[model samples]
Target: MDDARPPRARHRPGAERWFRPPDEERRGPAGTRPPWLSTLLVTAVVLIGSGFAGRNQPQRVPLDHVGYALLCAGGVLLLFRHRFPRTVTCGTAAMTAGYLAAGYPYGPVFAITALGVFAGIVGGHRRVAWAALGGLWLSHLVLAHWLYAWLPPAHDHAAPWGQELIVTAWAVAVVAVSELVRVRREQLAKVRAERAAAARRRADEERLRIARELHDVLAHSISVINVQAGVGLALLDDDPEQARTALTTIKAASKEALGEVRHVLDTLRAPGDAPRSPAPGLDRLPELTEQAKGAGLAVDVTTEGGHTALPPGTDLAAFRIVQEALTNIVRHSGSRTARVLLRYGPRSLEIGVDDDGPATTGQGEPAGGGNGLVGMRERAAALGGTVEAGPRADGGFRVRARIPLAAPPGRATGTDTVTPDATEEES
Candidate 1:
């Protein structure tokens, strides 16, 4: 038994008009709502307006069944303008030209053709719209001037040369309007795309910033806590007093780490609120040295030149760079001592940390693809500066950063540099 309903339609390659799948509706037309409503409105205007126009143009053909059918066809073609703009444009132009060739009175019927051309141009089918509309205009020119004498409803003489100029002006107006709308639509689309791209870039930068801040805060504090915990465990079995001191250091380090982490994370919870505390700066050098001492690493901080206050960004970056460098020394260096040199230049600040060493017995190099070194370099670079790290030919490791200060710090004055054991170096 042969069972069949209507035959299933086979979609031909490159034939857009023959297929309308489910996805076509979900995707919308060119990422916008379809123009079906406008098409229907224009179709109504064409039929109603041409009936009136037919009464005024007695020499032209009246609105008969054929004329109405051609006008409706011109409007129907526009329904697919957004999806297949070039196709709709050619189809509408052909239908309009046929209606004109039959000498049907011209009115809003031309609007259907113009709308198709507009959609084609705006949908990025520029050359096709231009070619179709031009062909339609030239076809009208020929029929009105040369063929009207024999083709229409009775004695219609040749149209005047001046009337041809009006037709030329009308065609120019249609093209100009279409071109302007196309350009404006593209500009709006470009602006929207740029805003979306900018938003994505900002989100990426924010995530990176948060990551860097958390790593800096936790790495130094956690390293100090790790060493203190080890010391406490080793001492608890023998020296109760030393074990108590190690526990105290661990508590302080843990408390400080929690505070800094909270500060960094608070920005995510309440972005517009003022910080709970001021960001750490180089003025806190004494605290850093004391923390290093807890981890059995001595840090000598020597300041040269004017020690004037720095911009908030520069100050915070300098403090973090030094903090991370000393933390690395504590974690990776066998050396028990480190030196931190802070030199204040007229327009920039230079920071250096060095430790005399061979690589810690079995521990490898520290700066190989480590986030600590990368974070230091990134901090310096953000301030329009540079960071250099390597083994000093004199038999030690060195990390130095030079950060430009846009606002020049004031003149140098005599001051004392703080040493690890509370000793002072006069500047």
Candidate 2:
């Protein structure tokens, strides 16, 4: 059984979706119904309204197939409004103008053309929409005023001048509303783009923060482990007791490294959860000196102006800068001795780390050649501070940082507060 139905009678798969009305086409976050309902509703309204309008105006030609076809064409053109806005606008306007020039009743046919104009303007075809609407109005003026007697149902008179004024007002209102809608849509898109960029920036900063934390923790701990491994090997047979001590240092350093690394990783797993342990600050200088001793680097710590409460951010940055400076001395400096000086003023804390060096690696440049110095600078700068590191004129390498302490009167909201130990140390 071969199907011999006309091609238009056959239903093409997904054809309904392709030609759905704009109102029925569901946009993201602006859900809509199927196109068929709007199409049938609008087409029915055009047919039924124009039918009634034809009876009221007996001087106009009675509603016929041509008039009904023109009304339906206006609605059909709207099916392509989203995809072919300019085409829909022009086509609907032409159909409306033809309906008028044919002496068919003026009714809901204009509504279809207005919908096309709205779609065109919103879809970034403002000029095309304006031109389509203007051309249609101009052709109507020509037919109704000058060509009326020759064009339509016998002996037609010129349309009222007031009707032209009403048409111009209607066109302006439509354009104004459409333009407003377009501007609002553009603003919403811009806001979404800005939010996405901000999220990317925040993610990048978090990545950098994690890298710096891992580098500082691993570099210091591994440098100790490396030094102890060498000492353990050298003293293994001779001074077996000294070798045992070296191995002990290795175990402790590895444990601390694991703890800090785990702390950093925890933030990634569950952000906003309170840390299991408090962050290290200058109060932990004695512990830092102990770790340096295991690496064979003797660190001398001194403080001026006594101790003061520091904002958590400034405290963390200061600790990291000093820790990284000490780590570099242990790994790269030929000198075994290092000096740390912390001068706490009323408004700022200045930290200095110095090593009398010829670099162990003989690279006369900065330590590690990694992002160590860069990380230090970033931390200080984030705290509204600065870091200066260079080979000193006095024949040693020096690193200096000045961090501001914009402390609050009492407990602060989100910012870190003065710890209990800091208060007791100040006393």
Question: Candidate 1's residue-wise lDDT over 104-133, tens digit each?
Answer: 897888888888888787777889998998
Candidate 1 lDDT score relative to the true structure: 0.77
What 10-residue stretch in candidate 1 is worst by lDDT?
411-420
Query: If scored against the real structure, what TM-score would every candidate get?
Result: 0.85, 0.84
Off by over 4 Å in 1: 1-33, 361-367, 407-427
- CA deviation > 4 Å runs, candidate 2: 1-41, 366-368, 407-427
lDDT, candidate 2, 208-314, per-residue tens: 67777898899889989999999999999999999999999999999999999998888767655777777777777888999999889899998899698776667
Query: Residue 119's C-alpha lDDT in candidate 1?
Result: 74
As a whole number from 0 to 100, the lDDT of residue 396 in candidate 2 is 76
TM-score of decoy 1: 0.85
